[model samples]
Target: SNLVYDWVKAAILFGVVNTVACLDHLDPPQPPKCITALYVFAETHFDRGINDWLCKYVYDHVGGEHSAVIPELAATVATFAITTLWLGPCDIVYLWSFLNCFGLNFELWVQKLAEWGPLARIEASLSVQMSRRVRALFGALNFWAIIMYNLVSLNSLEFTELVARRLLLTGFPQTTLAVLFVTYCGVQLVKERERTLALEEEQRQDKEKLE
Candidate 1:
C-alpha cells in the first residue's frame, strides 16, 4: 500500500513537470493564443470537473481505509502546480492567489501534523519523506525547464519574444516562488521526520524500562 502510494505521488510529480516542459515548447507563432486557450480550458473544464474527479478517485481508490484528506490534498496540489506551469500572465496571478489561499496555508499543515497514533505517525512520516523528495525534484525540474525554454527561444525572434513576455510576466516569478515553497516544505518535512524518530526512540526506551 505504501509502495503504491509512493509511486502514485512520484508519477504525478514527474508527469506534471514533463507536461509543463512540453507546453513551454508550443509553436512560437501561437504561444500567446494557445496558452490562453489552455488556461481557459483548464480553469473552465479541468478545474471544475476533471480535477475533482481525479481527487475523488485518488481518495476513494488509493486512500481506501485511511483518511482521504491527504491524498485529496495532494491531488489538488498537483492540479494547481500543473495549471500554474501552463497559464498566462493574468491567469497566473489569479492561480497564485488561489494557491496561496487554499494550497499553501500553514493551517492545513498543522492539522495534518496533529493527527496521532503509532500507525498514523509512521504513515505521516513516510508521506512527508516522499513529499520532500518529490518537491526537491520538482524544484530542480522547474529550474531546468526555464533554462531549456530560454535556450530554445534563442533561435527565433517570435519564440524569443513569447518566452521573454511570459518569463517577465509569469514564468520566472511562479517558478522562483515554487522553488522557495518547495524548499520551505522540505525543511518542514525534515523536522517532521526528526520528531517522528525521537518519538519512536522514546517509545522503545520506555518499553525497555517497562520490561
Candidate 2:
C-alpha cells in the first residue's frame, strides 16, 4: 500500500542495506545478490510507481548547466510537489512530500557544508585525527537535526508527543553534545578505506613490473 509509514520504513531499510552491502563488498567482494535484487526490484515499480522520475529529470536536464531557467534546489522541490499533487491531496501525501523534500535538501546541504571553506580551514589547522573527529562531530549534529526534521514522517501521530517528551523530560542538550563527540565516523572510515585500496592497487602494479 501507499502508506507513509511504509515509505519511511523503506527509506530506513534502504540506508541500512546499502551501507552493509557497500562495506561487505570491500572485503569478500562477493555479489550481494540479495541487495541487487532488492534495491527496489522491478517488482517494486508497482508500489514505488516511478514517481520520482520527474524530479530526477529536472535535476538532470532542466536544472542543468544553464540554471537560470530554474535553480537546482527549487527545481527538485517543485517537481516533487507536483508529483505529490498528482498522487492526491491527502494529508499523509503532503506530509510525505514535506519529509522527502527535507531529505533531498538535507542531502545537498550536507554536501555544500562539506565543501565550505571554513570546514576546510578547520581541518587544515588540525592533525588528521582531530580533523576527522571534527568532521564527524559536525556530522553527528547534522544527524539529529535530520532525525528531528523527519520524525513526523517516520513515526505515528504521537511523534509530536515524542518530541515534547524528548525536550521536556531529558537533558536534550547534553545528549546532543554526547552524540557529537561520538564521532561522525563514516566519512573518515570510507576515506581511509579508499586510500588503502589505492595503495593495494599500487603494490599490485609494482609486483607485475617486477615479474
Which residue pairs overlap in candidate 2's backbone? 136-184
lDDT of each: 0.45, 0.53
What TM-score would each prediction reach against the true structure?
Answer: 0.21, 0.50
Best by TM-score: 2
User: Which run of 10 residues does model 2 get worst, by summed lDDT?
Assistant: 35-44
- Candidate 1: residue pairs that collide: none
Residues 1-211 of candidate 2: C-alpha lDDT, one tens digit per residue? 2234455565666656657878777432222222111211111221332434563565455555423323656765676577677777777667766765655555556656766799767667899888767655655555444444445444654774576466546687886445445435543554466679999999999999999
User: Lowest lDDT 10-mer window, candidate 1?
Assistant: 30-39
lDDT (Cα, tens digit) per residue for candidate 1, span 1-211: 2223433554565566557867998322111211111211122221223345544564335434434466545545555554555464354344343533253233345345555577466656677667556444544433333333323322443554565466456667886567546645554554456679999999999999999
On lDDT, the candidate that comes out on top is 2
56: Cα error in model 2, Å: 3.9
